[model samples]
Every structure is written in structure tokens, then in C-alpha cells.
Target: MVRKAVLPVAGWGTRFLPATKAMPKEMFPIIDKPVIQFIVEECLEAGIENIIFVTGRHKRPIEHHFDINTDLEKHLEHAGKTEILRNIFHISRIINPIYIRQKEQLGLGHAVLVAEPVVGNEPFVVALGDVIVKDEKNVVERMIEVYQRFGKSVIAVFEVSPKEVSQYGIVSCRHIERDIYILDDLVEKPHPDEAPSNLAIVGRYLFTPTIFEKLKVTPPGKGGELQLTDAMRLVLEEEAIYAIKIKAKVYDTGTPLGYIRTLVEFALQREDLKEPLLDFLKDLLSRDIPQIHRT
Candidate 1:
């Protein structure tokens, strides 16, 4: 059983700039809860117990988020906010949190490699810190089912546009059965004309410990970083790797635009905010706004 999950949040977040200078991008909120919190909740919901974080120097907030904040808990209890206090207690108690600081920001593949000691020889899930899937269907659970059936590592992929192929790692695979693919190759950020297929690798991955050995030999590729796609391609050589086409809407919260869009979509999903937010959006869109120049 896949009982552990690795979250890689060591990126510098240059995409979010000054705000990220003081904060990790994963700490950004979807609503009241931060993005990392949502990711942890998702993992826990999927039966993941040992929540491991491949973090950096700037990611202490993540550690603190899962850890106990006694004073805050006491204050909330004193204020008679039992519901909020229970939520805090749940966050601290439910997760088996382990944090390993990556000495330097190498790459996603390197981050997962450093987690080898904690992961041991078992299979684990690698869920990207920035991507959130509002999956009512429990996507991780589905991936686990696929793993049990095929006895091969699973990669979550979704179809992307031809123009967007350059932004992702495209996979070449043969359709095995409904939603399953036997991967043949992985090309990281290929040109539109050069892309093998539109099936882009999404944030979620399930892998055997064999990936660590492959990652060891996986040299730095684009941006002079150890590309996970390069290592995954090596895995394809040894055995068949499977892909599950995710049917849920995947949210990428790594950039400013993606972050804001995720925020709006999540807000729309809430019961209290749905009607008011929809009305606010409708009212805002119905008018012609005057452009204001920056001072």
C-alpha cells in the first residue's frame, strides 16, 4: 500500500516575485487555508499517513503549519471557537509529518531523490506543491487502484493544447485500456511541432523506488536541473510505466495568473461565497471600468 507522499516545495518562486521574497508560494491561500494545507488534506484523505516534504530554507512556515501551535490553540479555545480549534487539532494530530531540507534547490527529481532515506524501498506518491485537483472522485485513490492492478508506477496525465506542449513534459504511449497508457517515452518541454503527443504529465505521480536509481544517473537537462521527466524516461526502459488520464480540473498555482484563477475557482466552490461572488463578478463584468494610470 502507498502510505507515504512526498511534496516538493523548494522552488524559489521567482514567478511570484516580491511577495514570495518573504513567503513560500505554497503558503498562498485558496480561501482561508493555504495551498500546502489543501495538498496535505488531499493526501490524508487518500489514506496517506507519512507526509514528507522536500523543503528549502524558506519553507519553515510549512513545517509550522502542520506542527502544533499551542498558544494559538489555547487562544481559540478561550474564544469559544470550538470548530476552528478542532480544525487546528486535526491538522496537528492526523498527519505524520517529516521534513527534510534540501541543501540547495536542484530540481524536482533531486528533491525526490533526497527523500530516499525516508521512503526506503516502497512505492510512494509525488504530488507537486503547486498543483491542486478539486477531485470529488478521489484521484489518488484511483491511482492506487491502477497501481494495484498493473503493478507498475502510475503517472497522472491530461491532454493539453498543441501550443502548450512546450510548457510541459509530453508523453509517447500506447493505449492499454480505458484511461490507461503504456508509456514509451517522455520529452520535456518539446517544441509544438516536435512534441510526440498532447498527453502532458500533470503534477501527480506514483513510482517504485527504482526511480531513485534512475534519478541518480539522470543528468541535468533543461535549465541545468535534474529533470524528473528525464529520469522517468529511463524508468520506461526497465519496465512498462502506466498513465491515468485525469478527468478532473487540475489547478496550477505556481504563477500569478494561475494562482489568482485557482483562488477565484475555489471561492466559487464554497457554499457561502458562491452566490455573492457570482453576483459580484456579474456586476463587475456588466460595467465599463475606467482605466487608472499607476502613480
Candidate 2:
């Protein structure tokens, strides 16, 4: 059973700039809740037990967000606000959160490698802090189901436009069933013509402990940092690797554009905010602002 999951939240959000200067990108709010909260909720729904967070310096806010605030709880209780108190306390009750500091900003592979001591020799899941999968069936749950059934490493993949193949780690695979593929190869950020396939690896993964051995030997490519795709390639030589084409809408909240899009999409789904947000959007769109377009 995959009881442990790793979340790498040590990245300095250079894309979000001034906003992320003081705030960790993972703590940026989608609407009312921070982005990491959604990922943690998904992990809880998927029955993940120990959530190992690979954080870094200036990430104390992430720890505090999950910690119990007794003073606030007392104040809410004294003011007779039970609902708000329940929501605040529920954060800490979700799962057993473990914090591990990634002393350097190496890369995804290095982040996962840092959790090796806690992970020991067990199969686990890695969910990127900046990605959120929204669907009826939780994305991590589906990946776990595949991992349990096949007894192999499973990665969540999604199709992207050919033009955008260079922006992701593309995979080459043979179809086994509906939305399932037996991975044959992986290429990181290949040009359109050089890509093996259009299927790009997303942010979720179910990896066996053997991956640590591969990651240890995996050399840095492009950037002077370890790449998870390279480590997975080494694993593929010895064990079977499978890919599941995700059936959910995945929001990559690492970039400014992606963050804004996710925020708007999530806000529009809220019952209370839907009407007001829609009206506000319509009002903004209805205005005749030719100068904005030219600029």
C-alpha cells in the first residue's frame, strides 16, 4: 500500500516575481484557500498517510499554515464561530505532515531524493506542489490504483499541443488499454520534430523505492541539476513503467498566467462567488477600452 507521499515545495517562484518574493508559491491562495491546501485535501481523499513536504528556507509559512493555532481557535470559540473554527482545525487533522528541508534548489529528482530516509524502502507517490488535478476521481487515487494492480511505476500523462511539446517531458509508449500506456522511453523538453510522442508527463508519480538508486546515479542535464525524467529513464531499463493519460483538468499554478487561469476557474465554481465574479467579468469585458488592447 502506498501510504506515504512527497510534496516538493522548495522552488523560488521566479515567474510570479514580487508576489512570490515573500510568499511561497505553494501558499498562494486560489480563492479562499491556499494552493497547497487543495493538494493536501486530494492526498487525504486518496488515503495518503504521511505527507513528506520537501521544503526550503523562507518556507516557515507553509509549516505554520498546517500547524494548529490554539489562540485563534480559542478566539473563534469565545466569539461563537464554530464553523470557522472547524475549518481551521481541520487543516492539521488531514494527515500526518512531515517537514524535510531541501538545503539546495537542485531539482525535482533531488527533492524526492531528500525524502529517502523517511520513505525507507517503500513505494510512494510524488505530487508536485504547483499542480492541482480536479476531477470526480482523485488523480493520485487513480495512479495508486494502477500502481497496485500492475506492481510497476505509474506516471500520470496528458496530451499537449505539438507546438508545446518542447515545454514538457514527453513520453514514448505503446497503448495497453484505454488511457493506459506501457512507457518505452522518455525525452525532456524535446523540440516538436524531435519529440517521440505528444503525451507529456504531468506532475503526479507512483515510484518504487528502487528509483532512489537510479536517481543517485543520474547525472545533471541542461541545467546543472538532476532531472526526474532522467532518473525514471534509468529505472525503465530494469522495471516496467506505465503511463496513465489523466482524465482530469490539471492546473499548473507555477506561472502567472496559469495561476490566474486556475484562480478564475476555481472561483467560478464556487456557489457564492460565481454570480458576482461573472458579473464583474462581464462588466470589465463590456467596457470600451481600446487603449488596453493596443498596449
Candidate 3:
């Protein structure tokens, strides 16, 4: 069983620029909660008991979010905000959180490698901090289901347009059955024509402890960073790696556009803000004069 999860939060959010200079991208608000919170919630929902966060120097807030704020708790109790107190206490109970720093700005593959000491010889899930999966069922839960049935490593897959395949890790799946597929191979950022399949590997991953050994052999790729995808490709030769189509609308908040979109989408789902948010969007669209009009 995948009882532990590793989240790599050490990446520099250069895409977000000045805003990220002072704040971590994982802490960016998605409607009401931060992005990392969503990822943590996913792990908790999937029965993960331990969360290993491979964080960097500036990621104290991420750790703080998981720690119990005794002063705030006392205040909440004094103020008699029972509901708010319960909510705060609930986050503290989710998992046994552990944090480790990845000293170098290595790639995703290296980030996962840093957690090897803690992960030991158990299967664990690696969840990217900035990706939120809002689905009919929990994305982690879906991957866990595949892991249980196949007794092997699994990667969450989603169908992306051919044009967008180059921006993601594309996979070739032999067959599909109710959101699960048997992965033949994975090609990271392949050209559209060369792409084996349109199914792209999403952020969620279930891997056996052996991946650390494979990652050691995996060479650095584009930008001299050790990509997790490269490591998985090597492991595929010896182990069964499956892909499950996640039943969720994934939002990549690592980039500005995706970050803004998540805010809009999540805001639209909020009961109190939906009406106002809709009206605001309608007003903005109605007032925009630069849009090319069709006769």
C-alpha cells in the first residue's frame, strides 16, 4: 500500500517573477486555500499517513501551514470560534509531516531523490505541489486503486491535445479500462508527430522504492535538471508502470496563466463568490473593446 507521499516544493517559481520573489508558488491562493493545501488534502483523503516534503530554503510557510499554531489555537478558543478551531485542528491531524531541503536547484528527479533516506523501501506517491486535481473522485484515490490491482508503479494520465503533448510527458498505453491503462513507455516533451500517444502523464505518481536506484542512473535532461520522467522511463524496463486517466480538472498554478485560471475557476465554484465573480467576468468582457468582432 502507498502509505507515504513526497511533495517536491523546492523549485524556483521564476515564471511568476516578482510575486514569487517574496512568496513560494505553492503558497499562492487558489480561491480560498493555497495550492499546497489542495495537494496535502489529496494525500490525506487517499489514506496517506506520512508526508515527506522536499522543500527549499524559502519554503518555511509550507511547513508552517502544516504545523500547529498554538497561539492562534488559544485565541480561537478564547474567541469561541468552534468551527474555525475545528478546521485548523483538522489539518494538523492529517499526516506525520516531514521536511527536507534539496540544497541544490536540481531537477524533479533529484528532488525526489533527496527523500530517499526517509522513503526507505516502501512505495510512495509523489505529488507536485502546484497542481490541484478537482475531480469526481480523488486523483490520488484513483491511482491507489490502480496500484492495488496491478501491484506496480502507476502514473496519472490525462488526454491532452496533440499540440500540447510537446509541453508534457507523453505516454504510450496499450489498452484502457475504466480510467486505467497499461503504459508501454513515456516520452518527455516529444514532438507531436513523434508522440507515442496523446495521453500525457499528469503530476500524480505511485512508485516503488526501487525508483531511487533508477533515478541514480537517469541522466540530466533539458536545462541540466534531472527530470522524474527520465527516471521512470528507466524503471519501466524492469517493472510494470501503469497510467490511470485522472477524473479531475487539473490546474497548473506554476505558471501565471494557469494560476489566474485556477483563481477564476475556483472562485466560480464558491457559493458566496460565484454570482459576483460571474458578474465581474461578464462586466469585464462587455467592456473590453479590443476583442475582434465578427460581422
TM-score of 1: 0.95
Off by over 4 Å in 2: 291-295
Give me the overall lDDT of model 3: 0.88
Better of 1 and 3 by lDDT: 1
Go through the candidates in order and give the clash count of each.
Answer: 0, 0, 0
TM-score of each: 0.95, 0.96, 0.95
Worst 10 residues of 3 by lDDT: 286-295
**What would the per-residue lDDT of candidate 3 be over residues 85-122, giving only the tens digit for each residue?**
99879998766999999999989999999999999998
Clashing pairs in 1: none
Candidate 2 clashing pairs, residues 3+ apart or interchain: none
Q: In candidate 2, how many Å is residue 276 off?
A: 1.3
> CA lDDT of each candidate?
0.90, 0.92, 0.88
The C-alpha stretches of model 3 lying farther than 4 A from their native spots are 288-295
